[model samples]
Structure formats: structure tokens, C-alpha cells
Target: MSEQATTTPTDDEQRGASTLELFFDLVFVFTITQFTHAFGHEPTWKSAGTIALLFAVIWWMYSGYVWLTNEVAPSTPARRTVLVVGMFGFFTLALAVPDAVHGHGVVFGWAFLGVTLVHAVLFRVSGGDDASAAILRILPTNLAAAICMVIGGYAHGSATYLWWVGALLVIGVSPLLSTARGFVLRTKHFCERHALVLIIAIGESIIGVGTGLAEETMNLQFFVQVLLGLTVIYVMWWSFFGNDNEHGEAALDDLPMTDRTRTALIAYGYCFVPMLLGIVFAAAGLGMAIGQGERQASWAAATALSGGVALYLAGQALFRAALGLPRPWMRLLAAILAVLTTALGVYVAEWVQLAAIAVVVYGAIIVDDVIGLRAGERSSYLAG
Candidate 1:
């Protein structure tokens, strides 16, 4: 527990993000904001799908960097310098995200490639059998993504989009196929960081919901609606950060190197599906608050809230499944809650009623903490 004893992360310690690493999240915030703007400009199902896919593709790149940094952070001074430069690459890529879909999109493509080059170079310089081995696992995938982005820049239209999307599917998956066993430090750090970053993202949704409600005219009516928004935020808070999350993180932290990496790769790494779902939920709630609630809102808004709740539950289910526990009631309840609220939001009259429906769904999410969260809390899982 002493400071000296904590000098270097061991094979067991969970390595969440450092403060500096957290600052890196600012880039992704821009990425998410860019997607939101793009969606607003052309709010079609296709646009939504495209935006989600693109956001996901960029997120994967960030994930790879985090995974590697968690394991080993450029141990020597020279390598560390390259990493600092890579940070700039991340910022450049983020700045270009808004234009990544078109127009001189090569800025994004080049920025993304530059970041990958940093990782590839890091692998070469780590000078250890283990430190650099996992790099190869991701090399092909990263290269594929890099190539697709760069090529798509010139190709334009559906051909370009399809090319990038295909590349993302392949790139997103290749690292999991990595049978490399030497990435203990990298995997452990990545898993722990995921727990925290996941929280950060969830936190952003809470902020979005609050700010959304706050932007509405504050009167007795708005007061009640704000309370309703806060309540939903509370529900989301409990579902993601309560005992279930703690237990799941503990389970992952204790996993063997390969399992730990796998848990992070496909299962844990995949938790962002819910995180984005949650954000969209908040955005829908925000939209409803800002008087975009004509037609009593729509199926989409309702689905956003409900789907978010479901994704939160599904994340827990996947986490437990990875940790060897298989209870699925939370996920089931989450899906049910989502369906209920979505239906109610679409059918209800008045903003107050929508708020009321959200409350009911959120209340269910809170109750799950008491009932369904027990199995996870009592489980023998805890990442090292």
C-alpha cells in the first residue's frame, strides 16, 4: 500500500487511466459531438448508422492505444517522446472528425495513420518479447483501417463508406484473434482503464441529461420535468456504477492474462455499445425537453431511452458471462424497461407524461440494483 510499493503496476494490478490519459478523452468528446452534429444535419436511419459506425471505428483506434499504454507506456525516454507526439496525432484526428465523412477528409485519414504509425513504432522499440508481441495482433487490423480511411477519402460516396465500414469490421475484430500471450501488462492496464473510462462516458450522459433539462424554461412545469430527468440520470447511475459494475470489474481484474485481454477485447471493449446507447437516451430526453416533443416524441426517442437501459443491462450480462457467472435477469429487466418506456414515450401525451414514463422505467432500473445485482456482488470475481 506504500507509495514505494506502488511504483510499477504488477501483473495483477488494474491499470485505469492516469490524469494525463483522461485529458486525452477530450478528443473523443469532439468525435462524439461531431457525430451528433452530422446526425442533426441529416437525421436519417442511414446517417445514424453511419455516424455510429464511424464513431466506433475511431473509438477502436483509441482503444488500441489505451490497451497498449496501459500495459507499457514507452518505458524509455525516446519512446516516450514518440508517444507524446502520438498524443498530438490523436488531437489532430479528433479535430478532423467533423469533416471525416467528406471534403478533404484526408486530414482524418492521415491523422489516424499517423497515430497507428506511433503504435507500430512503439512495438518495434519496446525491445521485449512480450511488450511488443500483441502489437502484431493489432497491426494488420490497424493497417486495414488506416488503408480504408485513406482510400475512402478519395473514393467518396457509398463506395467509400462501404470500404471504410468493411475495414472497420475487420479491424475491429482482428486483435481478438490475436493469440499472443505476452501482453499481460498491456491487457491488465487496458481492462482497468476501461472500467474508469466507461464511467467517464456514462458520466457524460448524466451531464448531457442535466444540461438538456436545464436549458428548458424553468417554471413549475419545467421544475417537475427537471426532477424527472434527474431521476432517470440516477437510475442510469445505479445501473452502471453500482455493485454490478464493481463485481464485474473485480472479475475482470483477476482474469488470467489471455482471458483478461479477451474480456477487454470483445466483451469489455464492446461495452461502449451501451455507453453510446445511454448518451443517445439522454439526447432524446434532451430533445423532448427542448420542445422537440411534437408527435408526443417518436419511436426513436423512446427507443433511445429504453435501448440505453437495455444496453446497460447487456453490458453487465456480458461482463458476468466473461467472468463465468451467467445470471441474466438484469439484462432481461433492462430490455423490458426499454421496451416499456419506448412504447410509453411514443404513445403518451404531454411532456409531463413522458417524464412520468421515464420515471417508472428508471425506477425499475434502480430496483434491479437491490434484486438482480446481488449475484454479481456476491460472486468470486475481481480482476487482480
Candidate 2:
């Protein structure tokens, strides 16, 4: 097969997410919101598990595009067209999220399959034989997953879920096949793209708060709840962005290609799933708590509220570990705090629970910042 040189910008060419890439991400903003809403509507163990499974599917699809864009320059007409169509496919997938378990599973499957095939074709066209061959090795795994998705779509109840699991299993293990030949990840663009996606996920949490409270009559308590929610979001943002962000960039920039690939795969690839999961969970909790207007939370709602924080903090810790950085002891502590607060949530008013969670997140950020500051103005990996 003849490989055409792609006009797509590589790390050597492009430094940050392009305008078209940003446009591509807009669809996912709605997709993440849909996931949060789905969980909010049915806050149960079963619902949570199903949504988590669906999110993995959704996240993997988007991440493939991110990797594609990172490798290719979007300057070519072909690449641009591919991106535009992929965006529509992603939007269609997002639309199918609410009813994915039952009625609309086929629609979800087709959209996902379209996006996956598009990514594979584009990667094949732009990459050399080695690259094409790597993609080829991985293609079967993706196709297998897509097929399972189709089967899952047609099936119902437990059978549908089993097929989706089959799909995820194929996707999860497939990456191992191509691990020996890592792909190019323009450090700056790669880091920025992932960061932007996380920010979008955080935005989803805020949107969740707004949607939840939109039904309530305007009052001081409503404003207070909104304020507290925003504070918690801010602190979460700070905890991730304040110190961790630079270290991640440094790791990507400084590490050798094989190490960089491994780090990217482990940290950004796998770790982000839980982080996104946590954000969605937190958003679901916020929506429930705010909508109820300071009512004492039901067991499900309280668990959603605190469980979300625990998951988020735990995801952060894993992200740090993946980068070969010092583990985020404070975040681990916060995760523990989250679980404890969740336990406390059962006894307290919903608002009190929200406030307490915010305090724990904020305290973690403060502690982490102090430790980083005390470590002093050390140079980043970029300096070398």
C-alpha cells in the first residue's frame, strides 16, 4: 500500500490544539453532559455501572480522534473532511446516549463504528508501512469491538451488556499489540488537548449544577448551593492544574519516545477514564443535590455525591503515578476524606455534605501547593 505524506501537523509542526480540533471537541461537551444526565436520572448501582461502561466506550472513541489529530496535520482537505464527518458521528453517538441500553443501541453502535472506521482509514492513509502495519494489527481488535457493539445493540438486558463488555475487553487488550511500536505524540499539542478535554469535563459538572437547579424557585439557598458547587469545581480545577499540569507536560517532553508513549498510554489514556468518570459522577451528584433544594439526600443521592469525589481524587492519584511523578499523597488523603464525607453525607443535609466535600478538596489543594512551593523553583524537564 502506498502511504501518502499527510499535510496534518505533527509535534514538530503544530504546538497546540488547532481551531478545527477545538471545533471537534465541542461535540464531546454535549456527550459528557449526556452521560451525567443519564446517571442523574437513575442513581443506582446498576445505573452507575452501566453508565461507567458506556463512558469507557464513549471516551475511547474520542481519544482515538485525539491521537489521530495529534499525528496528522488537519491542513489537508481529506483530513478536514474526515474530522467534520467524525464530529457529526460523535454528535449522533451523544444523542443516542440516553436510550443506549434499550431502544437506541443500534444507533449508538453504528455511530461508534463509523467514527472508529474513519479513524483507522485516515491513520492508514497518512502513515507509512510501519505505521499502517501497526494500525492493521490493531484494526481487528477495533473491528471486533465494533461488531460486539452491533451485537449488543441488537440484544437486550444482560445480553446487551455482555456484548458491550466484550467490546471493551477487545479494545483494552488491543493496545498491547501495538505497544512495541509507539505512535508519535507531539508533546505540547498532546498535553494541551488532554488538558482541554478535562476542562470540558469540568464544564460539564458546572452545567450539571445549572440544569439541576434550573427547576427550583430562585432563593438564597439556591444561590448558596450554586456558589458552593462552583467553589468545589474551582478547587478540583486547582488541584489538577496547579501543580500536576506542569509535571505532566514535563514528563511528556522529557521522556524518551518509548517511555513517553508508555506514559501517555498509561497516564492520559487509562487514567483519564476514571477522571472523566469522577467528573460525570460528581456532576450527577451536584444535579441531584441542587435540584432537591437542601432536602436530606436519599442513600443513592448521598452516595453519588460523595462517591463522585472519591473517584475523582483517586483518578488524580493514578494520573500522577502514571507519569512517574511522586504520588499525590494529598489527593489520596482527599479520596479517603471523600469516602468519609460520603459516610457523613447520610447524616447531614445535602448542602452540608456539599460544603464538607468542597472543604476537603480545597484543603488538599492547599496542602499540595504548599509542598510544591516548599520544594522551590526547580526547573522542569523542558530545561534539559
Question: Which prediction has the highest TM-score against the true structure?
Answer: 2
Backbone clash count for every predicted candidate, in the order shown: 12, 3
C-alpha lDDT (0 to 100) for residue 378 of candidate 1: 45
TM-scores, in order shown? 0.82, 0.93
- What local lDDT score does residue 77 receive in model 2, on the 0 to 100 scale? 78
Whole-model alpha-carbon lDDT for candidate 1:
0.61
User: What's the C-alpha lDDT at position 361 in model 2?
Assistant: 71
- Put down candidate 2 lDDT per residue, 169-221, tens digits, no spaces: 88877776557373676788888888988887898688767866656888888
Which pairs of residues collide in model 2? 8-72, 8-73, 9-73
Question: Which model scores highest in lDDT?
Answer: 2
lDDT of 1 by residue, 176-213 (tens): 56574655544445655665666666556555555545
Cα-based lDDT at residue 33, candidate 2: 88
